[model samples]
Target: MHGFIGEFFGTMILILLGCGSCASNSLKKTYGQNSGWLFICLSWGMAVTMGVYVAGMLGSLGHLNPAVTIPFAIFGLFPWSQVVPYVLGQFLGGFLGAVLVIIQFYPHFKESKSEEEGNSVGIFATRPAIANPVFNFISEVVATFAFVYILLNLGNFTTGLKPFIVGMLIMVVGTCLGTTTGFALNPARDWAPRFAYTIIPVPNKSVAEWGYAWVPMLGPIVGGLIACGLYTIA
Candidate 1:
C-alpha cells in the first residue's frame, strides 16, 4: 500500500516539477530558456531519484513511467496482471499533476498561443528538433536502454551512489538526445501532461501532438525489452 502510494505521489511530483519548469510561467522565469532541454532533463532525473529514494524504502518501485512499468511486467519484475493498475495510477498521478501546473499558470494561459513558431511549444508538448521519426525513435531507445541498464546494474554499486549514477545517466541522455523530440523517453511524462494540455482550458493550444505521442510510449517499451535482453545475456 505504501509502495503504491509512493509511486503514485512520486510520479505526480515528478511530472509537476518537471513539466512545470517547461510550462509554468513562474517556473520558466527561474529555469526556462530557448534551449531549456538541460533543465528539463536534470530536473526530471533528480525528481525520479528523489521520488524513488523516498518510495523504495517502502517497497515502491517508483516506476513513474509506463515504459518502465511495462518492461518490468514483461521481465517479471512486476506481474502482468498488475500492469493496468500501475498504469492507471501513473496516468492519474500525471494528469493531476498537470492540473496543478494549469493552476500555477492560470494567469498566463491566455497569453500562450497554438502554433509551432510561437510560445505554444512551451505550454504544449514537444517535437523532434530534426523531425525524423527514425532518429527520434533511436534516441528514445538509446536513452531508455541506458536508463534501464543503469537501474539493473545499480545492484552492483554502492547504495549511496545508485541514485546519483541513475540520475546522472538520465541527465546525460537528455543532454545528448534532448535536442531531438525534447527527449521524452517516458510515456507517462508525455501522456499525462498531454492529456491535461488537451482537456484543460488553456489558451491557443493544439491537440497534444497525438501523432507523435506513440513514439515516446513505444520507444521506451522497445528499449526496455532490449535492456532486459542485454541484462539476461550479461
Candidate 2:
C-alpha cells in the first residue's frame, strides 16, 4: 500500500508538471506560450527529479513509469509482486495529472478554434513529426532503450544524487531524440494522459489519434525488455 500510494502520487506529480509545461507552451495566452522544445524537456526532467524525491520519502523506488518498473522487476531490481499495483498507480496518476492541466489551462482551451489551431491534443499526448509509423516506432525504441539502460545503471551515482542524475538523463534524451515522436519513452507517460484526452472535452480538441498510440506503448516495452536482457548479460 505504501508503494502504491507513493507511486501514484509520484506519477501524478510527474505528469502535472510535465504536461503542465506542455500546456503552457502550446496553449494560447500563457506566459510560456511558444517556449519551444527546450523548455518542455527541462520541465519534464525536473518533474522526474521531484517525483523521485516525493516517492522516495514514502519508501517507493519511484518507478513512476511502467517501462521503468517492468524492466526493473524482470531484472530483479524490483519485486514482481508489486508490478500490478505500481502500474495501476502510475496510470491513474497520469490521468489525473492531465486533468489538472486541462483545468489549469481552461480558458486557453475554450478559446481555441480547433485542434490544428490549438494543438491541444499534443499537449496531452505525443504525435510523430513526420507521420511515419515504422520510423517513429524505431525512434521510441532507441530512446527508451537508452532511458532504461541508463536508469538501471544509475546506482553508480551516490544515493542522494541519483534522482538529479536521472533528471539530467531525461533532459539529454529529450533534447537529442524527442523530435521524432516526442520521445514518449515511458508507456504510462504516453498512454494514460491520452486516455484522459479521449474523455475530456476540451473545445475543438482533436480525436485522440489512436492509430499512433501503439507505437509509444509497444516500443517502450520492447525497448525496456531489450535493455533488461542486455543488462543481465553484462
Candidate 3:
C-alpha cells in the first residue's frame, strides 16, 4: 500500500510539472510561450527529481515509470507481485496530472484553434519530427535503452542526491536523443496522458495521434526489457 501510494502521488507530481511545462510553452499568451526545448527539458528533469524525492520520502523506490518497474521486476530487483499496483498507479497518476494541466490552462486551450496552431497532441504526447514509423520506433528504443541501462547501474537511485543525478540524465537524454521522438521513454508518460487528451474535452483540441501511440508505449517497454536482459548478462 505504501508503495502504491508513493507511486501514485509521485507520478502525479511528475506529470503535473512536466506536462505543465509543455502547456506553458504550447499554449497561447503564456509567459513561457516560447521558452524552447532546453527549458522544457530542464523543467522535466527537475519535475522527475522532485517526484522521485517525494516518492522516496513517502515509500517505494520511486518507480513512477513502467519502463523502470516492469524491467526491475523481471530481474528480481523488484517484487513481481507489486508490478500491477505500481503500473496502475503510474497510469492513473499520469491521467490525473494531464487532466489538471487541462484545467490549469483552460483559456489557452480555448485560444489555440487548431493543430497547426499549437493545439496538437504533441503537447500532451510525443510525435516524430520525421514521420517514419520504423525510424521513430528505433529512436524510442535506443533512447529508452540508454536511459534504463544507465539507470540500472545506479542501483536504488531514490536515495539522496541520486534523484538529482537521474534528473541530469533525463535532461541530457532530452537534449541529445529526444530530438527525434521527444523521448517518450516511459509508457505511462505518453499513453495515459494521451488517452486523457483523447477523452477529455479540451477546447479546440487536435488529433490524439493514436496511430503513433504504439511506438512510445511498446518501444519503451521493449527497450527496458533489453536493458535488463543485458544487465543480467553483464
Write down the RMSD of candidate 1 (Cα, Å): 3.0
Alpha-carbon lDDT, every model: 0.69, 0.87, 0.91
Query: How many clashes would you count in candidate 3?
Result: 0
Root-mean-square deviation per candidate = 3.0, 1.5, 0.9
Candidate 3: minimum summed lDDT over ten consecutive residues — where?
A: 115-124
Top-lDDT structure, candidate number: 3
Per-residue lDDT tens digits of candidate 3, residues 1-234? 878888888988999999999999888889999799999999999989998998888887898899989988998878999999899989998999899999998899899898766787888899999999999999999999999999999989899799999999999999999999999999999998899999999999988999999999999988999999999999
Best-to-worst TM-score order = 3, 2, 1
lDDT of 3 at 109: 88
Off by over 4 Å in 3: none
Write model 2 residue lDDT over 80-174, tens digit each, in one string: 99999899988998999898988888888877767665655789889999998899999999999998898878763224989888889889999
Clashes of each: 1, 0, 0
Spell out the clash pairs found in candidate 1.
128-181
**Best of the two (2, 3) by TM-score:** 3
State the lDDT of candidate 1 residue by residue for 92-173, as single tens digits.
7778888887787765555544454234534435577777888889888887887777777766322465766766777887
